[model samples]
Target: MLILKLTNITKEYNSRVILNDINLSCKNCEMIAIKGKSGVGKSTLLNIMAGLERATSGEYYYNEILMNDKSINSLSKFRQANVGYISQHSPMIPELTVLENICVPVWFEKDEEKKKEYMQQIESLSMLFEINNLLDKKINALSGGEIQRAGIIRSILKKPQLIIADEPTAALDDETALMILTHFNFLKSEGAIIIVVTHNDIVSKHCDKTYQLSKEGLLLIS
Candidate 1:
């Protein structure tokens, strides 16, 4: 079983401490929700968890493997292999078509077999997220909700073990949000570890565990 363990994780910006001695532990198949007011370092915590940012003074371990000490290149490899990150806004190239943008993550896959599987997954996920019809549209042409769905498809198409999302449903209507979360449920059942930072209670309701982050750190909420 894959396990994610953060031990005494702390983040500092200049002299300010963003995350203070935070600790968390979980394994695959668990969906976790982190709720907090804006500007409480929620995104910072998510970045640290996703290996996009290094913790100032702590240990981050995935299945007993140390991640804090890895070099930039090693960290990049780690993220490429294990992470599916959904940023709050679109991270796609404005000039690219939605389908091309969605295929960005696996554009370098040299294996012919994996390429076929990736194409199959792209088709399924695009249809599942209701963005197949918009595939030819440029990123700059799509609405916020459409871009959000496309972003979701791109992050998850690689079948990552860690799904880190920052306000994933902010731009979508409730129905569309439910559609995406329902798919997240399927991913969870398949042993993916999902972590979402959201202010919406509707998002929390779908998770197995919920926590509120404060200046002090993570606090469990029921």
Candidate 2:
């Protein structure tokens, strides 16, 4: 049931090593948090796993399929189908309406029935995240917290098997942060593997497991 595995992964930038010999694995429905100070390779590692960046060494496997240079296209397709990512800054399209933003992923589905199904799921997620009333509003009109919540809802609309969130709660107040984490917990109950990279202790403590990244590399902290 292991959904992700990283073995001896290393990343470098302009000859500077960022991550070194990192190995990690997580099972289906597991929740893990990655924590570190600003300069550590937390986001780098997440990007590697999500196929947004390549590791200079080692290998990755998603659902037991080897992921590497040879599998780039396949990996990208797989990620689009099964992985959802949320970054610290919500990436909603400025011109898209809230409902349109949520439905963006559904446009990739080839099946008419599946596309319609996902549209309905997006509607339900909008209500659950308390953005149903904002569905008609343009993304530029939303407050910071509202946009963040919309990002979360849009990411999960496809029910991706794995969710990677980078500093998702960093911009929110304590109450709002907790509410967002609670929504992640609810997603966990439905058997999604949630991996969050954050510097906040509050967010780290809420995860089922925690890892710390540093110049030395990744360490299991909880």
Candidate 3:
């Protein structure tokens, strides 16, 4: 079953076109990678998927519903509930401690029992990523890799249906990148659709499918 489908997707800035006539379909338990040079529209594509930006032309369907026609408010709600985005840089709040930053996803979770359950899950994942020791430290006190790890933990904490990550492992070492990618696989097994934009081979190689993005569109590379 298709969780996401895009056809004839295009994005343009001024007179320059970044993406042209791109088509993609992703399903449950699938992990896809978008790879390209630094200036390519890899991030743009991921942002489109995450509903952070709109395409210039095309159709976008999420769970068989036409999302392109959705109102701004509807899109925002849908994103908050179904999309987990990890951008190239850490989006953590400098004033928030590592644990607090990681808890952002569950901030509005209403049920007390479910809130505790999610907190425990976050703790387990923090330990798995070896970030548990830094939980009480301010975000600014953490290293680049540590901040990136925290960003990752926040993204998956809600276990959203779609995970759209942009260069998620760019700041991590090879061992740590592999550890994070392995966790993505575990999320996939639970029926999440993972899509990441990256230039790193470690990330591309770990995905079930990899595509190279260009001005012409997205071309399958693996």
Backbone collisions counted per model = 0, 0, 0
Q: Of 1 and 3, which scores higher on lDDT?
A: 1
- The sequence of per-residue lDDT tens digits that candidate 2 reaches over residues 1-222 is 757899999988999999999999998868899988887888889888888888899988888877767467876887788788998887888888988887778777899988888888877877877888999999989989889888888788888889999999888788878988887888888888999998788988889999988877778989
Provide the lDDT at 92 for model 2: 82
Taking all chains together, each candidate's TM-score versus the true structure is 0.97, 0.94, 0.95
Local error of candidate 3 at residue 40 (angstroms): 2.1
Candidate 1 stretches with Cα past 4 Å from truth are none
Q: Which ten residues in a row are the worst by lDDT in model 1?
A: 87-96
Best TM-score goes to which candidate? 1
Which pairs of residues have clashing backbones in candidate 3? none
lDDT of each: 0.90, 0.85, 0.88
> Which of the two candidates, 1 or 3, achieves a greater TM-score against the reference?
1
Q: Pick the candidate with the highest lDDT.
A: 1
Tens-place lDDT per residue, model 1, 1-222, is 999999999999998988898889989999999999898889999998898989999999987899898898988988999999997786889888999998997788999899889889999999988889999988888888889999898899889999999999988898888998999999999999999998778889999999989988898895
